[model samples]
Target: MRRLALVAALALSANAYPAQAQAVAETADPYIWLEDIYSPRAMAWVEAENARSLAVLKADPQFAGFYADALKIAEATDRIAMPRQIGGQIANLWQDGTHVHGLWRITSPAEYEKAEPAWQTLLDLDALSAAEKANWVWAGADCEPTAERRCLVALSDGGEDANIQREFDLATRSFVSGGFTLPKSKQWVSWETPDSLIAARDWGAGTMTASGYPFVVKRVKRGAPLEAASEVFRGKPDDVFVIPRTFTDGAGHSEVVIMRGITFFEAEFVRVTPQGTTPIAVPRKSTVTGLTQGRLIFQVNEDWTPAGGQPISAGSLVAVDPAGKAAPEVIFAPGPRQSVDADEVAVTQGHVLAAVYDNVRGRAMRFTRTASGWQQSVLPLPDNAAISMVSSDRASNTAYVSVQSYLLPTALWKVDAAAGTAIQIKQTPARFAADGLVTEQFMATSKDGTKVPYFITHRADMPLTGTTPTLMTAYGGFQISYTPAYSGVTGKLWLERGGAYVVANIRGGGEFGPAWHEAGLKTKRQVIYDDFAAVAEDLMARKITSPQKLGIYGGSNGGLLMGVELIQRPELFGAVSIQIPLLDMLRYEKLSAGASWVGEYGTMANPDEKAFWLKTSPYSNLKPGAPYPETLIWTTTKDDRVGPVQARKFAARMKEYGLPYLYYESTAGGHGAGANLKEKAMTIALEMVYFQRRLMDTK
Candidate 1:
């Protein structure tokens, strides 16, 4: 959950700044040279704002049918290959239009329950990025869960989260020549055995972390020389990242934990041993998550007790043991509209699975301990969809989940985690036309009287009489739940062209737990922007879309919630988009990985979080000729996590306040706005032709 995302500047004044925004409320940030990212005057203002917003969003006429229906639903080779177990095979990766940097492959679990499996590739990545000229991408692979054929892999560059790990070798498929590489930076590594590797990277200059991660952990062995690794565990330097993680249980315990993180929703965890590092009593808003019979599960998020037992609660799950002699227990406890999906928990050898959710609708529980104690069950699966685990196998209880919703169509079940049963196996093929489209889930309320939830979808016999074109979105921030899946590019570029989308579930998300994301943390983020402007004033008071047929969108922490609903409700959105954002909450902690989110945004050396970033920062409340709306601000110039300098100093202070927005960045997706499927089908056909020129044209 440490995926915090971004924001930055302004101390607000000078009639909220316009004479060239009084050099950003007097002196300094006047578009801080667009944060020098690739200078030459910031790549000539990002190639003149990406050729003037991709020439009016690729000259509209439905931008070549929304970039050929989002590059045919991103090169759809019958879409859902998804599975990842990796022991008796299954792994995956694929990608189409003839492998545009993909195809990791591997199949077997009885040829992945057959409907045409045979797989096997084991690493093509567009022929190793054309034999290493390198645009690489595919950052995954750890392998060695007890000899699953030695791995490590990672890669990344164009999709940048600093990668390059290497090692490989699944029964000699390739790369191990003088093995265990490592090179790049934002790393973590694992295995801890079959020739060692505890890791957590960038061990050079004072070993990183004022959020560029790697708070030093090290061990390294197999052909050594990462400057002769050894360290073990360090952490401080403004903490936020120290990872490690090795945990095995296949009837042979094995350990190595580490974690550390210290903010962006806390952490500490520890363990290691060959006689050292212990800590682990759990609760620094807990996590650990996985390992079975030798115990260690965790989850928590805040409400534990320990030192002589009994209290648990905060989104509970528990378990414990790390040889501290039993007594932790719970292993489930959610129910106040449940929550548990710490990125779809998993473990499996004799079950743990988890996925939960409840009100945000998703299922799978499993659990299992035995001898008169922990037991659980649930996993039959399908029901108001969402589900997801998708890969488990700690030497087999077998796993893979998936399901779907918002007009269904996803499927892929295959569970059998010691027979709590599941079975479907692959489905997908219905890209759009959900008959009359329905999906409900409402609730709204919010300007303090809480509630929120959202959903939408549309056209069940239309006309609530408010000009429908809609859109809407939310992330609220980090606890990251924002559920209801099925998208095939928002059902083929905007609900098969009639529109209406939504999503909300606001209050700093995780749907409804950790007290709904600590009820919007750090300076209580205006109740997560009044729960996304009360789900856009409850969709314009249920006429279902107004304020000129609404429109909103988010990205990176919901693009700082679409730059705070475009400056605190600019007449409640006509269109905003703002992807990969963070629009300056006072120099979002000197940008990039924004100082690992001062514990979910609070420290401008905390004077009431600098008066809530001078009254809630969207680039210091973007003022100038004010009634906002036309936004589409985009990001990604290889975003090393929220970098493209706060979307290039908020699109160069909205082009020095002459205002009307539209800017783009892209040169390869990093903080995701696209890196591959034809740069994510030209950033979803330039955000569905800028939400069809702001909520279906005809102004």
Candidate 2:
């Protein structure tokens, strides 16, 4: 989510006349000048202006009574917890032209009753001026567990003036306040243990700095600082497992191991007992991954061939005992001419079940081991549908997999290992009527002749006239497959609004596993962009949509996609929505939380990598006199993943170049725009309105 203040400014500038552009441009930073003129900011300003216009409309006698009655109805129906009002909170207020402080709250039935008298007394003070009355707005409740039930409240005013501190006297009992400064820059901060807080801070230059897994515990009277009871290992910590007392080796040594991935071949396991930390070596020269109780599983590649200097092969699963005394045992072996990578493995009483994925076959296979040997079984697959195994419940011997296809919506299934059958348990429901919805599988040839798979969805009955409004979205990096799934708000707002939605399965994604992803990464980065462009061109050639009626959207790495496309083919899209994008490639390695992406996007530390990155980075490609699409760049200040400064500086430069775009920044809400469901819905709604209004208006 973009910042509200920037949204207000952009909303007004979006529709500003050419004469006003100069004035607005002068006041805003050059980096985002173009966005300031026609982005979400401009739209938001229009809403504000309309609110004022409605106030004038209320002055008329016919409208005055209607407005009053509407207010009464709104207030009467403003009960909490209803679908329409959940997570709703009073954001701001003004009185006598002077802003006043406000706080939000949601109280339990018991707490509400206790505060009822005080609230009524405050309301009964009708003798006070209207400014005082207007100063208050209910924010909402904090539903987190607490010893005493309490109402959630926020301090919205009293920055320097006003006696509003007294106003919170009744609410102070529920307040739990403490602050911890982060040791490094991170995209997110969260609490894992009941009394422990963990933050993932990004400090540019491929280095990640961490704090607070070892910090003081707050709000707990008896809790000790996490560092006191914690032990830091030499290598990066990947996972933690607790061994039972019964399994002790009787050397007064109970194994607690930390697995560190140094490379695909080498993973170091450091074991700690009552004595001290000891290094335990298992199989190297292979991909030793996955975890189960009392064992570190290794999957060795049958044929070692270096692709991009990374080992690639098919392998088996092997396990070593905690004592580190004997040769590892082969628990399961891959089928001949077929490689298996253990997606998940779980141990039961004297039995082990493993979920494996066959890259060569593009399907899932399962194996179970008894006292005798291993028994393998092939799981049933839905017609034309692919399965990606997520996890297995060893206790029940059941596995969970996500099934998807070009024509079918994504469904989650629980596979019964014993029966070798899959049971469809849940699926995303189509929010809008699917009677007219159609999805088609299409292929696009990249610049290098790489065949890219893509899916297109639109109104089934629409003509192939090349004039329909279309929105194409793609994320072709990080080996993350873009599965076909149902989105309620997106369906209602975009598809139902007569817009076509296309998802491009470009390289750099795990659609076909690691090889597919590696094809579009680092020096091959341009392949992903070429693939995305090919998809866009294919849609136009098929007469499904034209450049004038096409819109594009993507976030994070995908944001990089939008940025590149807007610069490379500005005429290809009518409107572009780039959320939390990484645009500044030159300085990206310098920003907080930027280094983590170096694996997917190579570090610019090397001149060659730097040159390639600069060639494709949208920020570096922005020209002074080139025409660009009307772009909306959204980001958040609390985004620990990708710093908002990238969007800020990009918008500033675009504005400097006199490009038309908008930059909206959310002051709160981490990497995402909203903190709750309603906020998320509102953000989506705003994007739909912007895209629909712009794309549908093309001639």
Candidate 3:
């Protein structure tokens, strides 16, 4: 029996584990061996490897044909320049490449009229199918400026089935379309757009549908019976709704009236009459955007600057009555030097609750209005843990809060605000057995002796001999913290399969605060890399893992981290996963959408900035004869946010080096891995399978 057990264990270890592990048996900090494999002096060798990789990819005859076919559709479309805020002079040159085959995001009336030529040109495109041209009829061409203004363009095909929808001005161009059972259903029904001032509902054949906006009461026909009908706010309205200056006093408080539809003939009226509604002082610079509900809320700024200017100012809420007599009352007041934004207030059942973040102590307070006055309470959150309140369910009387810290994975709790008690609702599932999972907090010494905090999770059952498989993940840019949220991908394959996981809260992240983020940006980017390496070494010193078992993974800016690490210390990790990495630092500023990242990553235009960027850019440091890790690069062709060409070029270079690697690009998905639920699940499954197959084998 003992012999059989020993044979079984050896068989599992030899065949199921990664084959490359047998080559390197020595236990050492991977960073220490960087000089041995990397030749900083013979830098030309690295550049040659990169050149050879590019040559092979460009030499492929089929590559050009494939790209030409792809570009053909894009070129046939009528392209227009759309403005974006972040990346300077960014445009969405839409052409025949769009599946929906129509004009999108018509900014103004002029643009709408001008689009007719493009629409006709689109119709003239011979490549498009007849059905594709028909799809254009459903598209809503233009968006007006104000919520009160409604612009209707007749469909080219005079049919109710023409799928028209309202689009918002947000970056994504999100549109709300009326739901129907069939693609060409002819049941004509009016729906409220996002910008609609009022919403009304009608009952027909036991079903209720929105009648229209700026709703009015209608009498029911005889012999047809239904439940009581009324017009109510459709969605969660904004807290502050602004009225025009024509309705407001010189101080900005308007003698407004709000009418609620009670019956077809009679309506419940509440008016702030000039006699009853007293003129309240309001800032002249105040602007009001209507909330989803009927209540009117506005922001008042003492300074002429926009109301959204810096915080630390007083604001009031003015609730207009339909009867033109009662004046608006101030429901909320700014507390001392603390400023409250529009999102801080939650209105429910004729009462308002506010969740105010104390910028001083880094804590949050909950304030509610009572009959006596305003009541205040301190929310219960761990002193060290950072808390972010996401949402509250008034119907359930429950609020969801996420809590995380350096030593802990994120945990979600359901807090009963009325009771002031928090209940842990969900926790990250333990991938490995309890005895096998271990977490440790360590402070790594940077070049300046700055103590950087990092955490490592590994198999406790494994011997502390620095030989266990390890994967380190970090995102040290954009002031975004690498918090321990529950990840279905990482939990199942990496940790559960006898591997280790480490999350490095290095500099350039907002883990500690804003100061921590500013510490490792631009000229200080090297600090983040240094901090990441130090954490890897700490794991080695503790005899928790070795360099042969180490693998690093990151995406986006973090992709840049993994790239630079591979160039700087090729021996540090056995495998690297670079997903949509931002490589080619010098030319990145020239890519289709790379210019936007210049704010976060300093622009190369400035000589000093270029010098600093060159020092850390992974593309600039690839050397020959270096034992590079087995890399897997992934990207999406439909990624308008981060162009797929970045990954394509990097993968091309790695292949030139004759390096072991895999390149997988999704033809149809945006910067987000997938568009729908099923696609998202499949992507996660693929990632898990890839990591497990690569990391679990030990020859």
Q: For candidate 2, give the lDDT of residue 622.
A: 68
| C-alpha RMSD of each candidate structure in angstroms | 24.8, 13.0, 19.6
Select the stronger candidate by TM-score from 2 and 3. 2
How much is 484 displaced in model 1, in angstroms?
1.9
TM-score of each: 0.32, 0.62, 0.52
> Each prediction's Cα lDDT score?
0.81, 0.51, 0.47
Worst 10 residues of 2 by lDDT: 158-167
Best by the lDDT measure: 1
539 Cα displacement, candidate 1 (Å): 14
Ranking by TM-score: 2, 3, 1
Candidate 1 lDDT over residue span 71-178, tens digit each: 888898877789887667778887878888888988778877777888878789898899879899898998878877978999898998999898889877888999
- Candidate 3, residues 1-699, lDDT tens digits: the string is 013233233321111222222222122312222112124532233345435533543344433433343244223333223321111111122434444333333243223224332321212212232635532333223222223123222232321222333323333333224311112211222222322221122223322212111233222221223243233322111111111111222122332333332221112333333344233333443333222123444444332222333332334434433232433334444553233344434433223344332221123445444556446666676543446564443233355566654334556555666666676654443322445466665777866687777666666577788778788889888656665443434544566667777888788765554456667767778788778877777777878776667778888788888887776555456678887678767667655445545555777778777766555565544443346656767665545445566666566556665656666655444564543233344445444444544455543
Model 2 lDDT per residue over 544-581, tens place: 98777888999888988888887666656778999888
In terms of TM-score, the best-performing candidate is: 2
Better of 1 and 2 by lDDT: 1
Better of 2 and 3 by lDDT: 2
